[model samples]
Target: MAQPTAATTTSDGYAEGRTDTETVSRTLATSESGLEVTVFDSIRSISAARWNEVVERSTCGSVFHRYEWLEAIEAGLGKTPRHLVVEKDGNLIGLLPNFVVDIEKTPFRRLSSSYPGFGGPLVTTDVAESLSLLAEAVPELCTGRTVVHQIRGLDTKYMRYNNYLQSEGYEPYRRECRFVLDLTQGYGEIYDGMSKTRRRGIDRGTDGDYEIVEEELTRPNLERFHRVYEQVMDRVDGDGYPLSFFERLLDMRERLLLLTIRIDGEYAGGFLELLDEQRSSIHGFFAAVPEDYFGDHASELLYDYVIRWGIDNGYDTYDFGSTNANFENGVFRFKEGFGGRILPILVWERGCSPLWKMLKAGRSLYWPHRYE
Candidate 1:
């Protein structure tokens, strides 16, 4: 079993209390069994090769867990990272990509996973022990500073890890659903396997005058998509990231797929999906279209194009993003039509300080509509 040494502070100024000497000594220590865990203030400080190696070996790993993704978040969102790397016998074995959220004057100081997707620890088959050690180290890392420790992921694939967290006093909250389409069976079979209604929708969308064009991740193209995205968010009363977020994503063009739906050469709808070539999966991250185009099935055409692109590119699955399990709304219905299976995604959270209780009580008073 891996054992943790003394808790270390991050080199970045984000580590509020601890001094540099304390942090450096803690980082260099090892357990009796030669297991060591180090916390990094920035993803750039860690070896890309070593970090990605653990990601490649973990079953639940995704593009969101990649070093570049987290680096982008740091560069774009300005979130302070507290990335944990675990090693045994001098070999990297486990990783947890987390960030600290400490807004000025707000009583809430949270250490959480990256937004919009699965993020917890990605470990080897010896999941129980690796997670237990990491969990044990969390409290010390926070050191009475953070109010809450929150971990969110897209599926229950980490059932064992979740159970371990529960035993450690974490409350499992917000059960969401994710739709995934299996692409290993070949595109023809998968398309035929879809519900009759979905097939008809696709047929209509294909016959429509709209044309699907795969666009390069240019600033202008991203800006066009952002306009549609803003409109979609407005219609649904949803909050969105700044335009800079999409721009940062566009900067990492090699790892993305930007497909636009056009009606008579004018942009109508589109999706910005992430490509995980190593995992043979494509994640449908964000999509947008005018509310008037809902009936026109512009999204249907976009999805069809994305699925075909995945199949042609030899990907194994298409993740249609996440939805609330309690709400079977238009978004849920649209993704369900693809004949994808709905899986439960669990978010585990625990209040570590008294401020957390206060924050929960005054949640509406503080930020009423902000989706955490």
Candidate 2:
């Protein structure tokens, strides 16, 4: 994506050149002293230093809550940010990085702390009080044709705010869960821990004489992954993100990895992993194996390669990403083969009342809607 052309400041919406901070007045949040909450339309407006301070100190913080991540969402995907900031005695205490998402071909718009990733309220102090403030401001952001405000799951490590969110009218549920493997052990131990079936997958894919090569973020490789991604999404009745988003993410190389399995010097399959440096973890964001290569166990090879990479790189855990909560799903079983513990993807959502469900019934629903 090109640099966004500057737009003049406006009363009703955000401006490119000006950073406007809109303050919300609230005297009390459940009898606690008032904490001043404000809004920034563009993350570019805020000091990246100050914003990151909150993330670094906050218990619930992750890379998804960082300024750069939110900025990418705004610039790459064309989502308008409604980043909320919290303060008490002039000290930055909390932040919620939400973007406005419009559901196509429907009358639904919503505010998501993250639409394609994991993030929620990041609070450094007075956790419950800050959460309450964010909770109150969230509904108000869902104005106009907007019908919902969803906070995607926080990383499993810091997803303990269920009660806090539930207190503020956000319902917590799980339709997806991420499989996490401990990567601090030696490769021998890690390999032995895997299910016998998974061991066979590694053997089979290895026998196919494929190589797991780390691919550079070049146009051809990206286009190849994008095509594979689109096919995977199509099979699930889903929509994959545009190539531009991957380009932006690739720029943050310190926190991202792109790897592909090649057979006979040709790309056969690949996967994308997003690194959370602060937490010492790697997340499997995207993976695709063409139908022709399915028998080769490219998916298993990709996971094995990432596991080795994560362990060698000193990452504490390697995530297999989210899968349908159903026990019968192939994806679930595939990830489970790696011998990892299952944990719920902690998500808090509000809105999507009965009317919206009745309105959106069937028709191949995607996320947020699928959860509804």
Candidate 3:
């Protein structure tokens, strides 16, 4: 049964997706483990304190798994939040944040822990047992709600998830790569590591013709950013993040930074950075500059500026985000120029309908970058 979800706030100032105080609890899996699994239809029913405690404690915990991000996802993307939590002896043990994504005009429906972000089940302790219960509770509790119930952003080093995934007959589907720049090294070394062309481009930004503007989230600033952003999306033949998405993102202003590059006091281009303290990383997200501004190497300068800022702020890594495995992709080549370690984009999936997976697989050959 589906529970009604209304936008509300928790006592701690986190966004809430439900008004009800009660949870749809179920005692699932082996009773021998003494762990109780409870499935939540709302983020409000679960205490933010307890939820964040597990997130902070788990090695796999990321900002995406944190309570606030889920709040933003619900508001920004308008996806209904779902969570599967586990407790043993009345103590919190595990959490998996999920949302229902139904593609408009299509039969595709999924229960994604996070649809477009990185998140997986997190446990405070007793990792093996907690993960077992969390994984097992999904199929029984989530059956028929969606065609697939999958988790994203599981690390390759954590074989426990892989072990359970195989045990439960879940399939590994998406294999992509993310670029991570090592920030432990000195600034000079980091700069030197970049391709010669990129280094020269960054230096060009210092030609006294460009300025980096850090502005407040006012209407004008946002409109200008979106203007450039829309053109960039059109240029790449990609869909731009809706204006409402960014509007809903205002809830995350404390952890978000919007920087635009100015060439002779004109808005040339900029990018938004998600300051992720949980991972000790700065992620390069939502960036754009006009083609006219390309000559000034504004894009390269944006990367250089953000990377320097991350280094000075003590962030351990700078992520260029993910791209396709294909070398021919221009985005991939652009990120490779900055000298970052390439790592696989791990996404775990379990589809209830083989027909859907089959059709998706066939479609994927034509659109390798898409997910069903």
Candidate 4:
């Protein structure tokens, strides 16, 4: 639990020379408490087993923090990975899997976590101490660079981390909420606890001829899911990930579950869920339903099936993902019908350069809707 100062080394594993932005290289940083932080430019440099070990042991770890998820993201999104691994006494303790994104036609850059859902560092123990060490090393990681560093904490456990970041001059830019259904109770009890309207929707959907099936995460299945997802996103005017993202997600099919809904042999809706067998938790990653079936309660049916699947599989929790807390949109009301509690998801950010601050201020003025 000692506070450590950071020192950096070059990509060739040397202790001298500066980091080059164009190349994928390694940088080593050490702290005063015998703590060493290594920046790996490639996901392959860290063993999956070792990285997942820290994730499985940490409270904030999720599917997005896994090594395979980052690999797939890099493959699909073409983002540069700048993953940090923290060690103490030659033993692995923490990890922060992040990516570098270059804004098109702009000199500004963003150093953000793998995705917007849930990321930061997965620390086995001494979370605060580990974070302090990581925070100290962040400046070195951003040396000779001008980028905005944004980290999100999805779990309430991250509030402590948020406090630390705030003390270190980071700003809480956005607030989001996520819903989680506890599966430890009986399904009957869970169903009975749902709102009357939600219960009716579930019953109606279940009584219909809609067929629900779990499909393998293959290219064809992913493509079909993406098609439906795109339709829904278009209807809502939401931003969608490229098809290559779903394609890469299929690469880790062993850790993913694809649930598709069919009505009269026609694909109606579907969702992709991430499975954490060790934690007995399932996270709702992405979903899509056509506008034609908006009133048909296709989403309710999907959630019902997913919840029952979790129960059947002996999973302990069903995470419904995040929603903007600033507005109680239709999506938020829809998820609230289920018997899940709302938990805050905080995003901590810091401006690394004058240009980034000016750009951020300009964005606030030009795009006021973003902050709303």
Q: TM-score for every candidate vs. truth?
A: 0.82, 0.83, 0.85, 0.84
RMSD to the true structure for each prediction, in A, is 5.7, 4.9, 5.1, 5.9
Give the residue spans of candidate 2 off by over 4 A.
1-35, 88-91, 103-106, 156-159, 218-220, 352-372
Query: Model 3: runs farther than 4 Å from truth?
Result: 1-30, 102-106, 141-145, 154-160, 217-224, 368-372
Judge candidate 2 against the unseen true structure and give its global Cα lDDT, from 0 to 1. 0.76
Reference-based lDDT, residue 65, model 3: 81
Q: Residue by residue across 1-372, what tens digits does model 3's lDDT show?
A: 344356565432224554455444345554576877777666766788988899888888877787777866766667666678888888888898888777434556777877667778888878777777777766653444366776777346444577677677677666567789999896889888999888888887788578887778766777788888999999888857777777766766777778999898888979988888878888887898888888888999888888888888899999998788667888888899899998777777776655556655665576666432
Tell me, by TM-score, which candidate is best.
3
Error of 1 at 212 (Å): 1.0
TM-score of 3: 0.85
Off by over 4 Å in 1: 1-29, 102-107, 124-129, 143-145, 192-197, 355-372
Report how far off residue 97 is in candidate 2 (Å): 0.9
In order, candidate lDDTs are 0.75, 0.76, 0.75, 0.76
Ranking by TM-score: 3, 4, 2, 1
Residue pair clashes in candidate 3:
176-345
Model 4 C-alpha lDDT per residue in residues 1-372, reported as the tens digit of each score: 211134365432323222332233344666667777877776766778889889888877877788778877777877667788888887889998877766434666677875645678788866667777777766555534436777877666677676778887788875467889998896898899899999998888777778889997788888989988888888888878889978887767898999998876778989889997766789897999887775677888999889999999899999898876644477778888898987766778877766777787776676454532
> How does model 1 score by TM-score?
0.82
In candidate 2, the residue pairs with backbone N, CA or C atoms under 3 Å apart (3 or more residues apart, or in different chains) clash, namely none
